[model samples]
Target: MAVLRVSPAPVPAGRRQDRLSTARPPAKLQISAGAHAADPLLSLPDLPTPLKEKILCMEMMGIDSGRALSLNPALRSTPLDSLHVIISFLLTKGIHHKDLARIFGMCPAALTAEPRRDLAPVFNFLAAELAVPSAAFRRVINKCPRLLVCSVPDQLIPALVFLKRLGFKDMEGLAYHDPVLLASSVEKTLLPKLEFLEREVGEGKEMVVRCPALFTFSVENNLRPKLGYLVEEMGRDVAEVREFPQYFAFSLEKRIKPRHRAMEERGLRLSLPTMLKTTDHEFGLLLQTADSSPTVGP
Candidate 1:
């Protein structure tokens, strides 16, 4: 049999020098080329690959999530309209969680980080820019609301109050608090003010809130736990909150005990998850169980 002659495929002009070099290139260079060109899910400079992947994956999925795509530290610093646009985009995408990871670059563990994905930053940005009044926010959120994830009690209160102040009465579909944030800020004087805001807002609707359905005591310093006892207390009277099942946490820390107490009296429990769950059957609450020993403390 005749031997077949083999020849090397023609190399691109740009790659000839690379092929001639005997020294191995650095991993960083290889990664750069592989990531920038070959990998659509590559991470940018200064951000972890996971985070970069998380953000882009969410965006690629068209989820209307928040600013998971942004790289500038300064841009990340402010929750502005740009951030809102990003969030809205991600949310609208409604991408599946697993697909989100595959498209962007987030691991399952990273996706579980509630704080990093919290919408409070975006709300704060909206509140500042849109001047979301208590009544208007209530009205808008109530009309087409989205529930927030569970967080700390203290952290969640401020956002709830802010939403209330803006007219977002759809308490049934709001974000919850983070326990870590709550345990930190629970005992502060802000409790009374927060309660008061709720009462004041609820009173306008002719609804009576009977007990501090959502209450907290500082676990440490300013951190507070977003306790379910508060909602349980309110469930006694109000038609909506009376049957709420789970509890949630909040992001901001502001005291409003007197206000909270008053709302409780009206049967208006303000546990974000409880309200959301009551409104939408799908917006269920997830009460975190206590470990044998406290896993989290202020």
Candidate 2:
């Protein structure tokens, strides 16, 4: 039972008024060696009966518990600066920079760059105060969407790849919603066509495209049933005025919902869904899903 002694001096004139009344005088105590054997031993100043009792109650506990016991306004006689260390030390156990970033609506890469001498001590105190990893006791944090905000246009490709690595697979649709990043690249004419394709076809667990543009080319056996087709006899019809590509294709295995399935599956056996859809709307949503759900937990 090693004992610790705490001696608190009077708070300076300018600072003491902010956290506590300055009416209280400074304290000095000559504690017994027997009392010092306790984990937390306090030397007290001239104080009222109630205040003295509170300080005694805190000193009875060990150092870690003593700080907690002293949290009460009546028992906390430590100066404001000392209290700052105690608070920071105790708080460090519960929070880390990542958590702070989430709370502040910013990315971990965006923490303030200011230098600080006191910050190091506070950080060290916190580390010592909370040796346990906070992640062990808490659920994993959700990835923030704000990180995807990009000012540089070229970052779209790498950003998408990075997001995929981080388990955000269904992000193609978000490109339309976001003001930055890939969303900006989607032209007004092309965006809605993508969205209509998604809504009409039902995105990619099952996909099919059919058109008469490639009459003689041998269709892959695996993809034939998924094809959408228009009759060749209607070549001169207004619907066929739009030029068809050398081959009509469908992206068959996507993860988004509500659209982007095969034309055959959706009965959209049209000559030019792209041209027709594109003329009607400027921008559309393209949603792609991942093969598996995200992993989340502590």
Clashes of 2: 25
Top-scoring candidate (lDDT):
1
Candidate 1: stretches off by over 4 Å: 1-52, 64-66, 69-146, 149-152, 155-298
Task: State candidate 2's TM-score.
Answer: 0.15
- Using all chains and alpha carbons, the TM-scores for the candidates as numbered come to 0.21, 0.15
Q: What's the distance in Å from true for residue 83, model 2? A: 21
Against the true structure, candidate 1 reaches a TM-score of 0.21
**For candidate 2, lDDT tens digit of each residue in 1-298?**
2234556676767888763753554555534444432233333445544444434433332123243433333324443344334334423445443443242233211121111333333233223422313442112112222222232334444434433443444332233232132313333422333343345333311121122212222344312322332232222232232243322343333311113333223333333544234321221211111112122111
Error of 1 at 158 (Å): 9.1
Cα RMSD, each candidate: 20.2, 22.6
The lowest-lDDT stretch of 10 consecutive residues in candidate 1 is 283-292
Model 2 lDDT, residue 12, Cα? 68
Q: Model 1, 37-125: lDDT tens per residue?
A: 21432435676544444444445455433533332234333333443454444444343333433322322222333334454543453
The parts of candidate 2 lying over 4 Å away from their true place are: 1-106, 112-176, 179-298
